[model samples]
Target: MGEVTGEVIVITSGKGGVGKTTTTANIGTGLAKLGKRVVLVDTDIGLRNLDVVLGLENRIVYNVVDVVEGTCKLKQALIKDKRAEGLCLLPAAQTRDKSAVTPEQMAEVAKELKAEFDYVIMDSPAGIEQGFKNAIAGADRGIIVTTPEMSAVRDADRIIGLLEANEMQDLKLVVNRIRSDMVERGDMMSAEDVVEVLGINLIGVVPDDEKIVIATNNGEPLAGDESLAGQAYINICHRILGEDVPYLDLRKKKGFLAKLFGKN
Candidate 1:
């Protein structure tokens, strides 16, 4: 529940539109639900959505840029989540780009947050650039989020290579937006395939659920819902804590004879 120095974990993806921000939000919230002091930093400056997803956009008088510029202390910029205790968000500045902050500044912020929180979870902007570098600079652990599509998997491979070059230990993978029906029909790559292709330990796999879109639009994380996606994220938190959680069977169930054959 308390730590003198916390672990910094970056949730990143090489391509956009792969649910990186949403994963970060839910993972941070899920950890907070377990009574861990968690802080989610939005490193996607200019195109900030973490605040919106957490429903704290109007509460943001200051941002990460302000913290980096010394205009406001880190504590002053954090927006506490009313939905979960021990959870806070350091939002990105909508007016600034990734260049607004440097890798060293990000490390400094992480160090400061570590003293107060048990986990410093960063939501890195999609791609391998200054923003991604800044996001990973302070992290002792990294989680790469990717879908099972070919493009996503290819980008994830490149990101993993980059993470290795950065000497980031404890790197893991989270396959997001998996389609059960497609997998059952052999129309899409399975989670196991993604793990094999990426060559990293699979931390979690989120099923494709329509509720996630509604949750994001309503400014609530899908993890609070009882849907498959929600439970997947909760399981992700447990895995982050080093728990040996079982993966959910999200494949579609067919006729008795079809079920006899089992999923593809």
Candidate 2:
């Protein structure tokens, strides 16, 4: 209508160790690669990894708490990415706990960021406590990341309910760390199955790629990868921007010889 405002989307998963930070870094990088001004906020106060994933760990002189506490200005706290022209990061304070800043503080920070960037992506801490509330305080949309495992899926379902209960309308799901081989073996749940159980729109599906681990170890993001999972994350970014980019095919490939041998 009157020039749509920027969207604040939180990349969250209720359960920990389900690739929530990975999704945030990749999506933020993908959005920036699309020539959109993007700012990634790490709201996982006690345990922060977004900075490491984005390779901005060494560059973080000030953090979100510094800005919120008036020790530094917002501009000072923002760590500009060297690779992505329009990408910046507001890392969390490792020394501070989740209660250091309130949800209102997080919302205020996101509001200021939305005025400057096309997208403000928040990396929320796991659980349904104050940290989780702070992460989504300023978000207009939510992207829940989960693996195919029962534990992650169960946590994701709870997260969706909490988001809805908090009056956050726009909700999307991203099933991460999916193994096509497992699905082919009838051992893993399909993307459609996860969506049906959660009852939300599927934004994308990321495979359990070894390249992602390598990238993370190298202080890089999978979004810059040419791998299958990388392509999927990139497509998810396009969808966030209202593009109709289709999802990538993550089906496991079978060897011709194996097929001829009737290998299952």
Candidate 3:
């Protein structure tokens, strides 16, 4: 109920197809569900997809570039979410590349948003390019998302190094698309393994569920749903809020996540 002075957190994955944008949407939605004023900023530039994932693609009259380029006000560019109160999205410019916005501009925008919101979540694009730098420019903290793959973990480590080099050391890790069956069968890396390899604080482990794909297709984030993935995202949000929510025990049988968190 008090004035919401937000913390800017960047959700990034150095490699593509690692669920970074999904993480941003779900985290923003989860915080809003918990009654926090949240803004999801898509810094992906040319390949903007956060708007689509949050079901706000049709409502984007202006984008982050527009706001930065002085073509529109920041308030005018923000597309409010219909499903969650106090939640809005500052979409990326699909027509422009990452070079369209500078890191200074992003930092300025983040500062302005932080003064107005409880949480400002930025979705960084794939690769350690100008887009990635722009995304993390004004972040108070960083969430590095990676799957249970060696390549993903490697890229995550590289991103961590970059963040540390820039003096942003408050970083956490989220291992996504984890398959319990594969881990049990020794076919895939466990979340613990990924965390160990990355050598960072493990915030959450999201199970690989078809529900995530369905939710994305429906332009709905799974963070507030009843699915395992949804619970995982909620747990991540709680952790981000400095809560001590326990991680889901995915080492059980195939349906263990469902049984523990209730039916999907």
TM values, all candidates: 0.94, 0.94, 0.94
Model 1 spans with C-alpha error above 4 angstroms: 1-3, 252-264
- lDDT, residue 148, model 3: 91
Using lDDT as the measure, name the better of candidate 1 and candidate 2: 1
Q: 117-199, model 1: which lDDT tens digit per residue? A: 99999999998999999999999999999999999999999999999999987999999989988997899999999998888
Against the true structure, whose lDDT is highest? 3
Which residue pairs does candidate 1 place in steric collision?
none
**Regions of candidate 3 where Cα sits further than 4 Å from its true position:** 1-4, 251-264
Candidate 2 per-residue lDDT over residues 1-264, each given as its tens digit: 225568899989999999989899999888888899999999999898899999999998999999999999999999999987789999999999999999999999999888888899999998989999999999999999999989999999999998999899999999988888888788999888899888999999898888899988987776856888889989999899888987777876668987888657
- Give residue 157's error in model 1 in angstroms: 0.6
Specify the poorest-scoring 10-residue window by lDDT in model 3.
249-258
Number of residue pairs clashing in candidate 3, backbone atoms closer than 3 angstroms, sequence gap of 3 or more or interchain? 0
